[model samples]
Target: MYRIGELAQRHGVNNDTLRFYEKHGLLQPSARQENGYRAYSDADDRRLAFILRAKSVGFSLSEIAELLSIEVDKANRVCSDVKELVDDKLVKVSQKIIELERFRQSLQILSDGCCGGPHSAEHCTILQALESFEENDPR
Candidate 1:
């Protein structure tokens, strides 16, 4: 058996993460020591590892909980669900990539237009461009 701190240290997770998992029902109830401190078993360590691995792969807590609740015999069903979640995340990731590329292009344009020589704000093209942007932007 391990105390909460020991379990956290063994798993390389913070105590708050373990407590959050318990609060979210991702972890089973912990046994209590005679002094009322929580005691964890090897099974708890396995469960925490599973949760961390799932999170590393981009599974949300709720999604991981659903996946964990699935019976071992329903492997195909679990696979389908996980696949759908991954596909959705992929779409969002692709959109973000596009947005970041656009932002990079805009920044490049600003940098390219700026004069490298030292200049006052009143004569700076970069500042002028920023002022124009502020005037044109609605928010």
Candidate 2:
């Protein structure tokens, strides 16, 4: 049996973070002591470790909860559900990479257009491009 502080310390997490996980229904203690202190078991330690691992792999708290729900179901023995979630995240990550590439290209174009001459700011090509881009853009 371990108190909340001891459990958090053993796991290298803050006490409030453990409390937050409890509040989110991701971690629960085995029982409460008479003094209202939380009493955790080895099982709680294992569960918290799982939660941290899931977060490290880019799983949100809600996503971890969903995975946990499926994990608890002894009747359904399938891996497709977890695979689908991971596949969806991959698609989203791919789309974000594409968007970031486009943004980088746009910045490169702007940087290339600048001469950095000792001229007035009003004559800056980058500024002119930005000012006229919105009006000329069809998208």
- Per-residue lDDT of 1-139 in model 2, one digit per residue for the tens? 9999998898888999999999999889999999999999998888888888888888889988887777678369478888887888788878989999999999999999899889999989999999899889999
Among these predicted structures, which one has the highest lDDT?
Answer: 2
| lDDT at position 101, candidate 2 | 100
Residue pairs with clashing backbones, model 1: none
lDDT, candidate 1, equals 0.83
lDDT of 2 at 82: 80
In model 2, the runs with Cα more than 4 Å from the true position are: 111-139
| lDDT at position 59, candidate 2 | 84
State the C-alpha lDDT per candidate.
Answer: 0.83, 0.88
TM-score of each: 0.75, 0.75
Per-residue alpha-carbon lDDT of model 1 for 16-70, expressed as tens digits? 8888999999986469989988899998888888889989977788878876776
Error of 1 at 58 (Å): 2.9
Model 2 weakest lDDT span, ten residues long? 69-78
